[model samples]
Target: MSIKIQDLPNRAAFDVKSAQDLRTQFAKDPQQGLKAAAQQFETMFLQMVMKSMRDSVPQDGLLNSEQSRFYTGLLDQQMAQNLATSGKGVGFARLIEQQLGRTVTSPGELSAPAEAANTAGNALPLSTSDGRHLQYRTVLNNLPTSASYGAPAAAPAASNGDVPATSKDFVNRVWPHAVEASRSTGIPPQFLVAHSALESGWGKNELRRADGSSSHNLFGIKAGKNWSGQTVEATTTEYVDGKPQQVVERFRAYASYEEGFRDYANLLRGNSRYSDVIGSQDGTEFARRLQQAGYATDPMYADKLSRIINGPTLRQALIG
Candidate 1:
């Protein structure tokens, strides 16, 4: 049940080449690569701890001889390796794994459908072999800062008028990414557009920062604890005790509408509570399940979304 130090192996001979290989591997397959790198980091960290402990001991005795010190360093390195391999060292690996795990998207995971892939004019780009040019990368790269607050949004579609000129315009704007999202979740693109329209008040009332710039949070998704991105605080209407109440809530801010749509799709697909809504062909059923799953504070959230799905917006958009 116990590990003997005498039986421990020598320190691993990790070098610059090994480090470069790990970085390359992490870029290719994150789960395996991150786990491997994390283990190595833990081993190094444990070695540092062991070295520190050895250094703190007095050097005035027979044990402080040059040969003894050399043997002690070797022993400490072996002890660190043993502790790391046995899962008894500090949990640096787990922490690194957790942080890096979110960035790993599977190959073809976010690919668009056949229909959307063929559609040209949309901002949502197909993932390349390198994946460095993913459309959503714009969101992470162009994060909102305080100075950028209240600045004009990049897209002018929402700023044209009270309501969009036509539902076709909104559909055209989000359709490609909607298809991409649908390919992942099996929810229809029309339904996703309808949901976004409802959440954004037909593109009239997107969440805005203090200076009145749009947050592009088409889903009205509130910022949660795990949200490490930029946010916008805005007054929102919520149903409390079956009565409407105004409250300022923090919502996730995105660099663009496409980014917001992508996040929305991921939110529903990633969450277990929204399991009933995912892959449901029936828009009505999806709406009802999303509401039932506590997607919105409004008790009539399903009804409102259902109306949007069945309304003239969708009707006209479908006809076009």
Candidate 2:
């Protein structure tokens, strides 16, 4: 049965104990707890809406008695709760679930955090609950921990293909854009796709904001003087005298893959430094020229991209 207004506790009396109970339930079973919490939040929102609507109704001295007002407020509260409970509440719960819900991969196993998330975990200290960056940490930490008692889980089996299933999906999704880019830049679609995969770790890693949203910077293309857009500051590994060093850099963030690819294609086509890479059908030549043009600070950037372009994944992507 739905909770009634008469049964509701005083708003001020909704104390820490109630919230703690919710958090405890969340820790025990996140899916159900999140659903319940979302409904509660929705209920609170609806109550406010009801109060606003009630206040907007013009008051008549005859019907504006204190008893009428109190009873009417109670009725509105009940109606709000019922509306929220009907599975037609505003989509706030779904948005909350998409951001915080655990992705169950098996009976017990959870997918490892994305590379950007893992980097954030290692680089930033846990923030207070009220802090701006705490949401990501809280969401990630609420997942079943490594120490959580559960059945032994197996890793995902590879698909009936040469590449990882994730890679196949990535290639398939990005190939059409890549083909368009290739037609403009004289680069092969497979090479363009492979280069992006190499840059983004097969779409596992990309730059992220403090709020844990993707920058969608598939090419690791930094924002230079002539560019104007949102940017993210991230720690990148650079090679100096054959030694690796960590450096903080600002990178461009695009709204989507198409923008990122368009920018990447433009960078190669418009710059004289990358002239050696243009019109080069050979993946090795393209990779080497990009490295020579200071596309990245890593000494082995060419070799790494070459390896990716020559891998079975690229072959499969081309065939697909």
lDDT of 2 by residue, 137-213 (tens): 33433322110111011122337332334775666556546655665776656678888898888776767778877
Superposition TM-score, candidate 2 onto the true structure: 0.48
- Which ten contiguous residues of candidate 1 have the minimum total lDDT? 144-153
**Backbone clashes, each candidate:** 0, 0
Which portions of model 2 miss their true places by more than 4 Å?
Answer: 1-165
Model 2 lDDT on a 0 to 1 scale: 0.59
89-120: candidate 1 lDDT, tens digit per residue: 78876776676556545532432432232243
Highest-scoring model, TM-score: 1
Assess every candidate by TM-score: 0.50, 0.48
